[model samples]
Every structure is written in structure tokens, then in C-alpha cells.
Target: MEHSSVHHPEMPHIPSTLTLASRTPTVGSARKSETRHILVIYVGGTLGMKPNSENSLAPVAGYLTTEMRRMRELNPPSDDFAQQGSSSSSNSFSSAALSNEMRVPTFDVIEYAQLLDSSDMDQQDWLVIARDIERYYYLYDGFLIAHGTDTMHYTATALSFLLHNLAKPVILTGAMVPLMEPYNDARRNLVVGMMFAASTEICEVCIFCNDVLLRGNRSVKVRHTLSAFSSPNYPALSVMEAQPFRPRRHLLARPPTGPLAIHSDMSGRVMTVLCHPDFDAESVKTMIQGTSKEAESRLDCVVLELMGVGNTTSTMARTLQSVVNTASRVGCLVAITTQDLYGSLTAASVSRLKKSCPDAIFVGDMTTEAAAVKAMYLFGKKLTAAEVKEWMPRNIRGEVTTVASRL
Candidate 1:
């Protein structure tokens, strides 16, 4: 994908009227500054979109940053605004309140040259974002990814695996409505994302939208409501409350001990097959059984979105087992996750299916998105079949609620 870098010179400056918390004395009576810098990576999404020639909301290059500059919430604190206070006698109080507002961090936006609708995103797009984060990992205190809502969960899950041993906050957010609209969620999402990124509390890749901060790998876009995403199995890490700009913290991932490591070489040879009432065994066989020897060699894994609690019709069960057997015989890993969004793949639930397919690896309560991306990540590392099987069941990045079981 083509891309360009444009620097925004006007950094947000704190107002002089606001009294900051006393800083620790530094060398020779100087005080350490509290300001934080964040790198905002603007990968094309609905948040930055504007009306195109046909008047449909579409991503417009350079438009997002321009609009960001106009928002007073994002802009630097201005003394001029403090001077021209509110009309009532409470002007001083209002000015004082404004002065005491949450300190917005200075950030730079790197817009992709060819903005993409989330639907257009693929493994290569995931690679591009991963590479960008790896390249600028150390330069900024934290990172914010503005992505399209359609595939944001997938990208978030991919990034969680790609940016291994991540030590800083990498918050992903996007808007259902464009930022240019009068009433939109973009501003709040971006603002909350910025606040979280600047803090030292969260160190994992997370998605912040509709007031909830969730683990990137665990979150899924649930509906078309303003609260577009939710972590079905996992609890949210934090909640954004605007009254005093306080974000209530919940469970958080431990900080990494080693330096950040990025794994960009993702193998896209993994296939996800969904089980249904009208499932076709021949098609499943065709997918797992590659047409050519070369194609078969390239195929590494299959993530089957099995029926509730990892079950299927008795007729389809035998066929599915045979397909899994075939896939395993040819060095491809077969991992099974449930189609239901909220249940674990318990041994009791899948006992019948397990009897037919003892080799199938059951991923317990792991989101299909995480299962797919984790398979790709493991395959990209060129792990042996045994190693892949061994690691798939383990909670590498908190993807699975319970240890995966292999019958």
C-alpha cells in the first residue's frame, strides 16, 4: 500500500492559568515535564471519512487531521479562550474548570496514502500496520490506531500477536459516524484513546470504543449501536467517564519485561470454515485437500467454527473427522472453536464429536478472530505440527479463556 508522512507542527500546549501538580525537582532546580507524546496512525476508517463526489461517506486523505485540528478538545489549551470567558458571572469558575480539564497529549498523525475501507483490509494490510508500529515503537510514549469498524477486531487481534511482548499501550479506535458530522462518536473515541495511550497503566493492545476499553484480542464488533464493540468472554479493562475525565480501571495485563518484539511474517494460508446445517463435506474436503502439491504444502492450518459446544450432525461428524484426519496427515493443523460467542468448548459438550475426531484441537472459549490470527502467527514461525498443536492450546496472549484440549 502507498503511504505518505506529513508532520503536524502545532502540538497541544497546556494553558498557563492551569496549575499543574508539583513536579519532582530535577537536576539544578529544573522540573521534569509531564507531557506525553503519542503517535496516531490513521489507517483509513469511517472516523476520518467525508462525503465524496457521489455524496457517500468515504475516506478522504488529509481530511482527518485537518478536522482534528479544529476540535477544541484536541487542540492546545489557549489563553485567548481563557480571556474570553463565559457570559455569566460564573465565567471565572468555568475558566477554572476548563483549566483543570484533562491534559491532552501531543500527537502526530500518519495517514495512509490510499485510505481503505475496513472491508478491503487483509493480511497484507495487517502487516503494514504491524510494520509501522514496529518501526516507530520506541519514538513515542504510546500509539493509537484509527481503523475502520468493520474489521477492527480482526486487525486488533492480529496486532496483539504481531506486536509480541508489547510494553506500551496500543489503543485501537474508530467511529461508526464520520468525525465531520455534527453528532458523532469519533471525537469521544479519539479523545478517550489519546488519554489512555498517555497513561502508564495499560500496556497491552486494546480497543477503546463506546466508553469501554477492551482487550484487543477479546473484543468483537457486536452491533450497529454507538457502542459497537464488546468483549464477550473477557471483562473490559477500563471505562471512560467524561464528567471528570476519569477512566475506571479493571483487569490489566502485566507489563513486559523484555524489549518489544514484532512478528510481521504472517502466513495467510490458514482457512476458516463455518459449520452449518447445510454444510457440504465435499467442499470441506476440497478446501483442506489442496488441488496441487505446492498448494497443499502452503496450507498450514484450518480454524473450524464448529456448531454450539463444538458439535455437528452425526452424518457431518464422520465427514468432518475424515477431513481433519486428512488435514493432519498432510501437516496442517486443525483447531476447533465454537460458533457461539459466549460458551466454552467443554469435553462433555463435544464428547460425541471427539469420539469421531480425537485429533481435533478444541480451543476453549477463544474468539474465532483470535483463533484464526493465532494460527497464522504460529504457522508464520514455521513451527512443527507437534509444536503448533502444543502451542495452540496454550494461552499465549490471553486469547483463550481455558487451556485448549485435544481429544
Candidate 2:
């Protein structure tokens, strides 16, 4: 089923909104319970970027699948290739890889009609991917997303929230280098991610890169290197060396018993402000008070990116409480998170912020990427301001660590 998003006039291909076909009921199809048929959703990124006319790296249509099909390890030539009669050229080609290896599962690719640079993705793109999984939920055993590294963390976090009670692995992967280039990391990332996606033991959104598996919401792109992501506050759920066992201990204990739930209401708007010496409450007041009549433009939450100790400047402290009171009245949420990558907010700082902004949420140890998407998820689900605070500290998706500290 082909689906197209609402396109922008200037950027015709990149849609401002996406629409997916209605979900179909799971008719007792011929999907073998024991078989691993992974569905790979390829949303373009650096993994498939090729040099174009200006000699600048850009995503080319049909470039990814063309390059990927040549990987013998993924689509290995089988001796039984003669079994498929005349249709062997296309039919046998797909089946041959099915018997490739136990670790190498058969997969079908659904390339987006308009390949998006990861930077071009929006909340609607996340919703489209979630609905895609729902539409084909009954057909495939697992889902793997090929995304750009730039905003992979955001999409991964959004998916973690949008797709609830997931019963299969949803692994997102992309390389710093494009697959068309020699000596690139795309193959290793893709192959390993495929294996994980095919595994029945893992049942949550995760990012597999640089030989390690990090929880989707817990991950962040640390640098512009092959080692793209890191789970700073938590240990990796699985590593290449400890796979098939490490996940057993560190990952979600077991797949959820309930049927998978998909939440498409990620319409929440949020803003991030770094607390500097110039940080002031007046600007934040304007934001929470509703800057525009456009519902989509208005913010539902504001993430206060605080210092290492989670405290802001005295400049902003002057009218912080009053602004917070306005936020509470207008149904806006105030979230506090530390700037440190590895360290979480302290109890003393959290208490102080909580005292000042009674309705403020102390996002403990959550990466800014995770925090931002989480706010969008919460508001998009139509949660009340009180509910946002209620859910903020709780570990709904393994994104935050509940730290107990003294003032």
C-alpha cells in the first residue's frame, strides 16, 4: 500500500503532514510463529547518502536498496537457486536469503517514496512509521528502521512512546558513512540490527550502532563518529559480544503479554531554553502564555535546560515562581533537566526547583532528546498539565532513572 504525506509547496517531497492507511484486522494469516520475517523501513539518512551534482552528499532515490541487495552476507546466493523455475531471477533471489543463516533472517524492504534527510523528519513522520508497523503488525515478526543518525534519537524516543506494549523488537540503525562508500559501517550496523530485530527475546525500541545496543529513549548521538550513540546514565542492554544473553538481563525482562498498542497523538509542542546568566522568566512567560493562536504553534511544555546542579541564574529566579504560576494556570508544564551527559539531577536541586515551580517536573537523568519527545508524547496524548507532571518522573518507558538523593 502506497501512502503520501501532505507536501509543502517549496519542498514538494517533504510533507508537512503524513497520512497512513487504516489498520487492517489480523486475519489468521499464514505467518509462521517460528519464522522470522523482519520488516525494514528505510527512511533515508547518511547510510544511503551519495554525492550528487554539486559533489555534496545527498540521499538519492532507489540508491539504498540497490546497494543493499549486493551484500552477499544479507542476500547470499544459495545452491538451491535452481529450485525456483524461470521466476528465479526475482523470486529465487528473495528466497535464497531466507536460508542464509539462523542469525541472518529474511527481510522485506519498504522504501519510502520520498526519501527524507533525517533532519527533515517531523512528528508526523513518527506517526506514519508507527502506523506502518500497525498496518503490517500481524505479517512480520519484527521491525527495523533505517534512519539518519542526526535525529535517530528523537525518532527512536518518539516511537518508544507512540508504540506501547510492544511485543517485538523495533531497532533503528544508521551509519556515519553511506553504504555506497567503501570501508563504511552500514553493513555491520544493518546486519547486526537485523539479527536483533529478528530475535524474539527483545521487545522494545532500541538503537544498535558501534557494536552496542542502547535503549531507544536512553540513547543520544554523542559525536560525529562511527560510535554514534551512547546510553550515558544506564549500561547498554546488549553488546555484540554479549548478545542473546545480555539482553536477557539488562533489557525489558520479557515481551509484554498484552496486545501491542499504538498511540498516534504525538501533537505536543515543546521548547528548550538553556539557563544562562541571561536566562529570564519573562521570555518563558511569553512562551507558556501562548505565543500564537495556532494550536500547533503554541507550547504545551517548556524544558528548562539547567546547569550541572540543576539550578538556574538568579536573574531568572526573580520572577520564576510567578511565571510558573502562569504556566500552571494556562495548563503548561515546566520540566527541569541537567546539562551533564552522565550525571542526573540531584535531590537538593530537584527539591528547590519543585518548591519554586510547584508544578515543575524534574526529569531525572533523561537526555534532552528523550525529554523533548516525551513532552510531545504526553501532550499529544491529551494528558492534563497535572498528568504531565505525574507521568514525568515515573519510568513509563525506561527513559529516566528514579534517583534518591538528599538536599
- State residue 267's C-alpha deviation in candidate 2, in Å: 1.0
In candidate 2, which residue pairs get closer than 3 Å at backbone N, Cα or C atoms, i.e. clash? none
Clashes, model 2:
0
What are the per-residue Cα lDDT tens digits for candidate 1 across 1-407?
Answer: 66644332232221211111111121123222445567787888999999989999999877887777666666634442333234443433233343222445556667777888999998888888887777767766788999999999999998888887788889999999989899999998998788788767767789999888899999888999789998999988877554655433446766667777764477748888898866776777676778777754547888888775334556667667877888877777788887788867666767866777878888778888898888888877767678878888788777777642211
- Candidate 2 residue spans exceeding 4 A from truth: 1-35, 79-102, 242-248, 292-297, 308-316, 403-407
Misplaced by over 4 Å in model 1 are: 5-32, 78-102, 242-250, 295-298, 309-313, 403-407
Q: What range of 10 consecutive residues in model 1 has the weakest lDDT sum?
A: 15-24
Query: Which prediction has the highest lDDT against the true structure?
Result: 1
Best by TM-score: 1
